[model samples]
Target chain A: SQKIEQNSEALNIQEGKTATLTCNYTNYSPAYLQWYRQDPGRGPVFLLLIRENEKEKRKERLKVTFDTTLKQSLFHITASQPADSATYLCALDILMDTGRRALTFGSGTRLQVQP
Target chain B: EPEVTQTPSHQVTQMGQEVILRCVPISNHLYFYWYRQILGQKVEFLVSFYNNEISEKSEIFDDQFSVERPDGSNFTLKIRSTKLEDSAMYFCASRYSPQSSYNEQFFGPGTRLTVL
Candidate 1:
């Protein structure tokens, strides 16, 4: 079985600082990885994705780096704001026989930005 | 931008009762999905629908659970008999072909199901 472990600790950082979240996986290597942001009582919103071949991907204030050899990925939110406080999740693309269209998600790390 | 919309942001039902959560995905997207998240747990995939049929489903999507796209605009998940463990937030998502975009998914507001 595959398991993705993300830091369960709530991170508290000052606004404008860089926030780095880590995701580590065990078992099969994934073809692709994704990051999403979720607020309380809300669905996750897609952030960025990096393929096994890609080292890094970026979108505005967010950046994602994947190291397949290490079986880990890092999600960074730079110039963070109070509004950026939310749980960040990492998911790996899975192919379960039914044909590859689903993702296996991690527990997610909660972030708290203080202004 | 077109968005996926779900009905009854919150629903409460008794155990063993049938519940149908409805969603209207973005008009032009070719893929649709259903995912559930138990409070404080990781989001789990339920099923995926495309071309008016089930493309993939998870173990959690047992016989008691079913999905249907009755019309051109509506996508639905029906739970034959709601269980107390069925309490969770159900989300509807849509996406265009991987060739068209970065495989990004657009999610709905989610319907919170509370089984008593």
Candidate 2:
């Protein structure tokens, strides 16, 4: 069975500091990996997506690195702020037999930025 | 910006009752998906729809669950007989086009369903 795991523990950091989250997977080959920010009781918002061929991707203050060999991805938030406090989820794109793509999400890691 | 939208922010119903969650995805999106997240759990994919048919569905999407694109813009998920375990936040997502090598899905606010 395929499994996606992230740091179950919440990460607390001071504002302006960099927050790094990890996502690891096993027994699955995905074409791409994406990161999303989810607030309590709200839906996930897209962040960054890195394809299997790409080593890293960045969007403004956010950066994501994908290592297919290691079966892992790292998400980094630079100059984090209190508003950045939320659960960060990592999703992998799984191609279905019918040529459709669906997302498989990890348990997610919660980050808290203290001011 | 156009975004996916779901109706009925929250719903409460008794077990074995029928429930229909509605969503209107981005008009130009070609793929639509339904996912559920239980309290404090990871988001689980239920089913994916495209070309007016189901492309893939997870084991969680049993016979009791069905999806329909009744019209061009409306998509719905129906649970014929909801169970207590069915309580969760259901989300609707859309992808602009699968033809793109990398298309990120846009998610809606989600509908919180509580079965008592």
Across A34-115, the per-residue lDDT of candidate 2 in tens digits comes to 9999999999999998989999999999999999999999999999999999999999998766676679999899999999
Which residue pairs does candidate 1 place in steric collision? none
lDDT of 2 at A110: 94
DockQ of each: 0.83, 0.83
TM-scores, all models, native as reference: 0.96, 0.97
Model 1's lDDT to the true fold? 0.92
Cα lDDT for residue A28, candidate 2: 76
Give the per-residue lDDT digits (tens) of candidate 1, residues B64-83: 99999999999999999999
> Per model, how many backbone clashes are there?
0, 0
Candidate 2 lDDT at A25 equals: 94
